[model samples]
Target: MKYKKTILATTILSALLILIALGVSLVVSPMVERKAEQLLTRYAARVGAIERCSFSRVEFSPLSRSLTLHDVLVIYRSPKGLRKSMDRLEISVPLRAAACAVPSLRPYVLPENGSMDVCNSITADGVSFSMPGLLAGSLKHAAISGVSADARHVRAILDGRRPEPVDLLEHAVIDGLDAVNLRATVQTGTGSAACTLGAFRLRGLHDLGIEEIRFEQLNAATNKERAGIALFGMDGFRAPDAATLRLLLSVRLDGKKSPQALDKDIEHVLPMLQQWLTATIPPVRVLAVEKASFRGSRPQDVMSLDLMRLDWLSNRPREMKTAVKDLVLPAQLVESNGLHLPGLKELRFNGESDTRDEDGRIRETGYLSLARFGQLRYNASYAVPGGVFNFSLMQLLSMTIHDAAFSFVDQGALAYIALNQHDPDMAGPYFNQALDYSFPGRDNDALRAALKVFTDRPGTLDIVKTTSEPTPLLRCFDVATLGRLWRVSATPGKESLYDQMRRLAPAR
Candidate 1:
């Protein structure tokens, strides 16, 4: 009897222990799942922010330790105040491995079923983003099945597939992995663009290691339009490693036109453009055309041009212009290195008088080629009251003169007079008058004496007598002009001639 009782007690204790262990496993599993869900949610938020997107809803499953997110939306705003939205995004993630590995801490899991709406805001037909293996650290591989968006000013269809894997933590020395396959069509009003990927894979969390990631047959539409700019075809884009990113893009205008015709158009409009540009960026001194070409229709005035290759180093605007005027240089000029002009070579101008408005302003367009010495070859066209004028200068003197005038205007009479003498056209009358008042009663004899000492010319007296104008004894002289003349006469031996002229002139 005692033996039988002991056996029963042992059996009961074993059953109780087994039941307790089972309960613990059940409780721990659910807790782990909840932790994973929380971590994933946080990660999703971070990713969305970086991508400029948001998710409408997130669903979590405790039993499988998985998360399903849906209705991801991305938005963009155009310069014209138009808002665009991409919607209907869905993603799923498995947290089983992450949950089991870190029971006490939460694990991060990326979503699957990478799909989204494309260009929902601009076009009548909705676009899509389909990827088979889009999520990093997911259980299955994904690929983008289809993608569509507003192309040109209209909508078109796109079809292609690309698979890529990315490692997020390789550089950080963390154990992580990522892979993505994106295939889609970019739709436009007239045509389509396609992209295909071989593989994009990454491993090692902190120090990212990539394995054979490539983009193939990545092409855009043959034609498209947005705002006033035209887009040709996209050649291909590639990022071999973390250090470099490269892309090849080509584009043309909406219509067809000859390159020579385009060149002529740009030549006509460059001067006014230069003036306008100077008003904005003052450091630019010289704007020369490099090369120009054009394509498109004439009636609608639709065309495409390239000025990016022009030399722009000496083309900075003057400070005076900046303070007094609101000016706009071409986008190409602004983007170039204003301090270093190497590609510009020439500038050309052409235009039609008939096209000029009553105010003498004509519309024009053309191309520019920046060849060498930071020079630009431009083809321009426009209308002006006096007709179109296109000319190039080895140096831009007007800009220099303008700069000097503004810089010296704040100084006293002597400085102002000196500046005016260099360029009388730009000086104010007040400056001229001030100089006259300061030199009152100064006879030509004293002027001759001063000039004799500073100049080297032997026949200074003869030149002075010939150049001076008859005036009343108290009449004011143009100090600015006198100063400039003195400089010219004072060259080496000409100093004496300058002195003689000063003496022959009437006193102020």
Candidate 2:
């Protein structure tokens, strides 16, 4: 009987202790919530210079060291006023400080006693920002993971609807943000379009592996015009200088100006652009694109490009190369302009230029080749006394031409052009007669021979300037005639462009 009584008494005492614990929880939770709210209000008031901030509710968990806010809003009034709001914001701070204390020494020592995660997570849901004449952006959800100061992981889904139908990112994951891929939808006046940014890696301000940037209309039937970049990439990217960045940002962010005033505003910025070009500009190693295309509703509106590339191989002596291949233009469009030549497939261009200081003169040498149904190659060199070039017309005219040569290879285009003329059968003889009558000199005879050879049987013909003296560009065009200055010489070329470039840039 005594043991049973003792057990009952002990049970009553346990029930009383449970009641006390419940009372403490109810009282402490409200107090913690109020304190969190007060702290947030104080912070907002203290740093409310650029923006006014407020929240409707605050929830805090002391054990987990996590805090959540509901109905957070911020209003900014710079250049033009804008508003931002979020449905909920949650931040989970680490329960222990050891993990974040020495973030740089990661993957070695972890938080003691497994007290906290390696990263503190902060999340925002239903975030939206809007400004007139600019953009309206929203985030369905976004999260930052890893150390709070330096996040190692981030993920988000962002959408934009102003300026264009820009659905910025359907989903994105930035693992240390080393590499990222983004896809978006762009709304056009005619129809909707989709854009994709291929995988790219980032280190500090440098970027690499920018595999592609593509755009294409979603519904071609409903669109009046369609355009796309099938592939695009660049290497050796350096971020612009701080001042340039600030200038660019100010122009975009200062939204006080109206659309009508934009052109004038840009005009005022051109002088500053000159400084931008010469200051803190680093060369991009390589930029390439494959298969950029465009099409309009009309059949004559089609255009396609197979490849385009630019290389800044060297900056010391300023060596550069550029190429354009298989650029197609609609034959119908050409015919509409009253040209009779048909069956033209594509146009191509390859060029290389080098500038260097030799002795006391600045020498520039380059070769340009253009090909459509036929091919034409021009190689030239110019020299000028070592001095700053002010880019004036007089300065350009004063430069001396050291050497120049032009070459042509027939690929059936000459025959088509001759056949389309009146009196096709006698076209060759007539052209020869005209050449003789128009030019009468020793150099003229050489040109005549080259032309006759080409007419007899379509073949390669070369013309080179014999002038060894430095001739000013103005005198070359105005005083000296081409027939008197240049001579025809036979130099055959059958090498493909790929082989030609390989020879030109042996280091590559």
Please give each candidate's TM-score.
0.22, 0.55
lDDT of 2 at 78: 63
- Cα lDDT tens digits, model 1, 3-103, are 99999999999999888877865777566446545655554444422333455555443444334444444432322221223233223223432332343
Task: Return the lDDT, model 2, position 152.
Answer: 24
- Writing each residue's lDDT as its tens digit, candidate 2 over 352-465 gives 555544543455555555454467777676664434333346667778887777777765555555545634446657777876776666646766676666665666878777
Candidate 2 whole-model C-alpha lDDT, 0 to 1: 0.56
Give me the runs in candidate 1 sitting further than 4 Å from their true place.
1-140, 143-170, 173-181, 187-191, 202-211, 214-508
Residue pairs in clash, model 2: 165-187
The reply for model 2, stretches above 4 Å from the true place, is 1-191, 194-203, 206-225, 235-272, 278-285, 298-301, 313-316, 336-338, 345-372, 384-395, 416-423, 455-457, 478-484, 490-508
Instruction: Give the winner by lDDT.
Output: 2
